[model samples]
Target: MALYNKRINDQLMTNCLALSNELLEKETHSFFPNIMSYWNHILFGDLILLRRLALNHIAGLTPQTLSALPTPKSPQDIYCRKLSDFAHLRSQVDELIIQYCTNLTDENCEQFISYTTTEGESITKVIADLTQHIFNHQAHHRGQLTCVLSQFGVNYGCMDLPIIVSEGSRANA
Candidate 1:
């Protein structure tokens, strides 16, 4: 699910890259205020969740990888001011996510992870569920982004996962 989520996000990001700066920065008065905010939020969420996963020193989430992520005070913080810059950073972080996901073991999934939220709350969750939440969170915000894009009459093409699956199947045939 994590790897698939990355693929979907990559496609979504590609669509976002094609958008003009005006549309990317346009205020929609939505929960996130703008398309860029949604993108930044998604990136922030992924970094935080992945950092928590890294705390266990799991495979592919080494100290080097953790050092690569910036420390954000809150999810709403503007880490990437421009979509272009965001895309660059997003690719790096996405690669980190991919590495962590691919190296994850079944034993790792069975362990519980504890972390503090941005709201100053301590929480404990199973690794598998937390991993799902990371992807689900991206999908949630990506859905919002797509809705905003639709409002602008922009076509982002098909978002179906089957497209990715089918492509892989064809390649392997």
Candidate 2:
């Protein structure tokens, strides 16, 4: 999971960097208005999940720096006007996520995380499940971004996990 997450994040950062500023900011008819909007939403979602996991406070089992992250009120609240800024922030947060997942233990994965939703609803779930949700949520929005990009005739390239793994193995061989 950590490897897959890291690869996809690397791909996202690369793709964002390759896009023109105008392309990144182009408004679309999707739920997220633009590429930057979806990118920021993905970052905010990871930060929120990391902060919640940090509440566990188990030594060496939680992300120590997540407490300082700002809680975004909405997707729009987190959008970066500059593509470079957004890409840099995304890369940093992706590194943090990779670290968090790498350090996670089987025991820690089974523990429950309890937190209130942005809407003020209390909820609890296994840490592993929450981690899965975070990745799944990012993929959902990424799909939307690809659709928006397609409309603009921008091909973001292959995001398939199996293709990544196969390519990596071939390179290693």
- In order, the Cα lDDT scores of the candidates are 0.81, 0.74
Error of 1 at 97 (Å): 1.4
Q: Best TM-score goes to which candidate? A: 1
Could you list the CA RMSD of all candidates, in the order they appear? 2.4, 3.0
Q: Given candidate 2, what's the lDDT at residue 98?
A: 72
Model 2 CA deviation exceeding 4 Å by range: 58-63, 67-69, 166-173
lDDT of 2: 0.74
Best by lDDT: 1
lDDT of 1: 0.81
Per-residue C-alpha lDDT of model 2 across residues 34-134, encoded as one tens digit per residue: 78888888877877777777778532534547544565565456647787877766777777777777777888888887888888989989988988887
User: What is candidate 1's lDDT per residue for 62-143, written digit by digit as tens?
Assistant: 5567786786668888888788888878888877877777788899888897888999999999888888888889989888
Q: What TM-score does prediction 2 earn?
A: 0.85
